[model samples]
Target: MSEANECLFCKIIAGEIPSNTVYEDDSTIAFSDIHPKAKVHVLIVPKKHYANVAELAEQDSHELSHMVGIAKSIADKEFHGAYRLIFNTGEDAGQSVFHVHAHVLTGEVMAE
Candidate 1:
């Protein structure tokens, strides 16, 4: 497994930082976003650190599927089975944190 020394998501996974965790397993965690862009916004991340989807693909493709599975489960319960799963790969794509995470958005129509 890979890890970063200064990654915020790493801290959260380590329990060094507090988060409103919704779901968790040995390999991944899902939590509510602090600054939500939609009514229901959750962040699903892997315990192992990866900078982005491309990095994650290089490291472990299974983890990507696992993260998405968790997101689908969350959406099924919270938003009655309707949601958007997003991955912002770079700053220009709106990715802020370096760690790879899936944004599960629902409960409102997002601007196009």
Candidate 2:
């Protein structure tokens, strides 16, 4: 059920697709967004493919938190002013992209 083959993030992490990687470690990768919602927007993704939040139950807690921690670090580096972190889990939530990722947006509304 984990679409590892067709998953875009999997390709990105695997070096099949080119992404502007700003930060990377064994557990996570931070890259610039192809579509920017603010002055600074980046997608923080786990090295392993996860369809969405619902599928995250199979992932380790340490890796999950590490991804989030990397998100905060990237946001602080790029969007020094302020930022918002969001994740859309399913179709109803507007998750056109199934690769479990955190959207870090800055230069936008505080509540966004």
For each candidate, the alpha-carbon lDDT, in order, equals: 0.89, 0.80
Clash totals in order: 0, 0
Off by over 4 Å in 1: 1-3, 109-112
TM-score of each: 0.90, 0.85
Candidate 1 residue 44 Cα shift, in angstroms, is: 0.4
> Candidate 2 vs. truth: CA RMSD?
2.3
| Number of the top lDDT candidate | 1
Residue-level lDDT of model 1, residues 1-112, one tens digit each, is 3448688999899899999998999999999999998899999999888899999988899999888888778878877878899999999999999899999998766676
Per-residue lDDT of 76 in model 1: 84
- Tens digit of lDDT per residue, candidate 2, span 67-104? 77776776667667367878898999989879888888
- TM-score of model 1 vs. true structure: 0.90
lDDT of 1: 0.89
